[model samples]
Target: MIVFLAALLMILGLIGRMVYLMVFDAEYYQKKAEDLHERERKIKAARGEIVDTNGTVLATNRTVCTISVIHSQIKEPEVVIKKLSKCLGMEEAEVRKRVEKVSSMERIKTNVDKETGDKIREMELAGVKVDEDFKRYYPYNELASKVIGFTGGDNQGIIGLEVRYEDYLKGSNGRILTTTDARGIELEGVAEDRVEPVAGKTLQISMDYNIQMYAQQMAEKVMEEKQADKVAILLMNPQNGEILAMVNVPEFDLNEPFTLNQDQEISEKSKEALNQMWRNGCINDTYEPGSTFKIITASACLEERVVSLSDTFSCPGYRIVEDRKIRCHKVGGHGAETFVQGIQNSCNPVFIDIGLRLGTGRFCDYFEQFGLLGKTGVDLPGEAATIMHKEENIGQVELATMSFGQSFQVTPIQMAATVSALINGGKRVTPHFGVRILDKDKETVRELKYDDGKHIVSEETSRTMQALLESVVSEGSGKNAKIEGYHIGGKTATSQTLPRSANKYISSFIGFAPAGNPQILGMCVIYNPQGVYYGGTIAAPVIRDIFDNIFPYLGIEKDVEMQYTN
Candidate 1:
């Protein structure tokens, strides 16, 4: 009777303890139970796409699967390895190593196609799973390869616009709260609590698909014909600073960005080739503007009112400054000519005289005003340029060479943007590619913007410069650049390269069309071109061809009917 009574009292005390626990620790115990059964897994957000102004997709996504294995749940490791190796085209050992990893999930491969993923899923091999993911694709292949750079393995933009607009392209990742049993088996009939990932914003760029193709085609043809190391071409609107097309050749396939396009055995040479392949010279690299820079000096002279149309200067083929004699293109000299005629003749000595007149202080001021002293505020990566001479220390020789566009380095885009200013009523406009950002629903999130630009010269000066440039195409060094029916004004430049003995050169051309009210501005730079190295002979024709193709597409009517002869 005493033992029964003690048992009953003990039972009552345990019940009292349970009641106290339910009342005091209920919330904490419930949370612990929930945590034991639930697991959270990441859901990768879909990367945004890139499209041209016409809504033709340039960069898009491919639906792919990420194949992974849970080591704890994989019962027959050998079977899983054998099947995965065959389906994924990987080594059996590689599959085995991945399956044996000490982790919740080991990714065997990513970017597996749906058909291949379906084949793996049909096997239903224990612990093997296929999850949804995305792979970036450039449908246009090599078109605008540098401008629309390819992404990395993790879908991050590594170059060009891909890197420039990363924040908008990379969206927030979501998660799935899965309910699983103690043995790592997902519970039956229990719906997964999901937080859906938001898709990234889209990048609407200024590149037109047809225009990009035209520019690239011209670049490729010239790159092969010229047998040049590389070629870069850029076309932009002088008014708004929108880049219509930018091409760098030879272009590599964006799909296989790491693979070398050239036929080369794997070595240090191959490594260098790869680095050179990915480089975007239009923005990241710098080259001496050569004769293309002459326009800057002329524009500066005109803007500063140091030279007039009627002002006459004599060129004895060369000018003497501080023991140095800078020679003109014409060895015999263009002696006794008006300032306008000097520009038409592209007389180096005449420019040297003009440069000496401006002095270093005044010339550098015009240079800074023209956007050469700093970056153009372009929305790209790795912009570069060099101001060889400082204003404070400028001497006779330095000013002389600079006057004729020598001894300094600037990128092609910088020269293009500055040229636009010279023609576009002297407005110092900033060059740019992006147009606007759009949400998943195609709603306008915001406008991709740039500065409104400042006036660097009077309208009258701009008009006068346009006429002089037009004369260059009509009767000067740039005559070959003329599109018979349209008035195309441009300057030709041939610059000497390093190690003066090597005789390498960069041949370039900068031009605009419809001389009266110029619309499109362009510049082409050809590096180490074989055989002929004159800009008028080599680079000007390339721009002329590009203009021939793009002129009609842009609906810019030929002001005068000077039918082009094929």
Candidate 2:
């Protein structure tokens, strides 16, 4: 009787403790259980777009179906592998290994085309699943390849404008939480939890497709004809520093950038080829400005009042500065000539005279003022600065050679920007490619941007330089660059490669069309060609080709003779 009474009391004590625990921790336990059974979901945000100034799509994202398999749900591994290999067009062994390794987890397919996705959905194979995601597409393919750039496997920009503006291009991502079944399907009628996605802003660029195509076609043709190692062509608006077209050959296909962006693991042959293709030579590679730099020299001389257009100099083939000889293009001499004639003929001795007149002090100062000695800060990737030797104390020889565009290295963009100032009312305009940013809904997020130009030289000096350069094509070394009705001004360059050890040469030409008003400024560069590699022979014809194709597109009235010839 006493044992029975003790047992009854113990049972009553245990029941009392249970009642207390349930009353105190009931809500906490219930919440924990609910959390354990909850489902997680990802909400994808839209990527930013890249477009042209006129709303033409250069880069965009498209919806694609992703296929995955739940290994645990696949009852017959070998049978499933066989069936999957057939549907996916994959090797049977590959599918078998995939299924064997992770039977219970989801295995993602590489990518599924529209037909494949439809077939898989129709088959409704057990454990198969599909999801939507964004994939980048370049509608223009190889067109403007270097300028537009491309992305990597993770949907991130790896190079060019895409990489440079990744933050702005990749918008905010969203997330969600919900209940799901064992099959990982969302539970019916479940409100769950969610975070809204914010789409990325779209970007509009200054590039014109018509102009880009023309320039690219010409660059391809010239590269082929010259059998040149590399060719880069650039077109810009001198008035506002707006880039219309920029192309480099051999070009890449954005659709097939995989091989293009490979690392060292790729073949050495592929690495070499890809390295050349990726240069964006116009902005990344530096070359001696050659006689093209004479414009800067003449401009500085005029600005400093060191020399006048009427000043006359006697050229004897070469000039001596600190015992270093600077030779003129004319082997014998240009003889006695006015500054105007000296410039028209691109006489090296005359420019050497101008540099001496400016002296070391004023020459270096103007060099900096003209935007040489630094990067142009263009809106592109991999910009190289003008490589000037450490000669803060410029000697006579250095100054003289520099006057004729030697003893220093400058990028094509910097050279073009500096020349643009020579004719654009003497304003130092900053160069750019992107015009604006937009959204998926076709709304403008950012407007066109321009680099604030600073007036560096007198308007009169600019006009005089314009006339002198115009005379070059009309009656001097750049005669081949002339387009009849349109007054074009340009300078030919054949800069010897610096570091002397390489024994390489960079042939170049820089010019602007409609010299009277100045619409387009252009440049063409061929690096280390086989033979006949003077700027006149290698670069001037490229300028002519660009003008030939792009002039009509710009609504430029053709010369009467050109119309008749057509």
lDDT of 1 by residue, 506-559 (tens): 999999987778889888889999998898998999999889888998997877
RMSD of 2: 5.9
TM-score of each: 0.90, 0.86
What lDDT is obtained when candidate 2 is compared to the true structure?
Answer: 0.79
Model 2 agreement with the true structure over 1-566: per-residue lDDT tens digits? 99999999999999988887688877887776666556444555667888876778889887666666666556666667777788888888877777777533455574467577777778767666665556788998988888888877557887788887788887887766767565545467988688877877887788988888878888888778778877888899988888999888888888787574343478878868776676688888887878898888999999889898789999999988877787887899989999988987789989888888888877878888887877888988789888886767567888888889888888888989999988888888888987777667777766756667678788888887788888888888888898867778898988777567987788888888777668899999887777787888779988987897788888777443211100
RMSD, one per candidate, in order: 5.9, 5.9
lDDT to native, each model: 0.86, 0.79
lDDT of 2 at 426: 84
TM-score of 1: 0.90
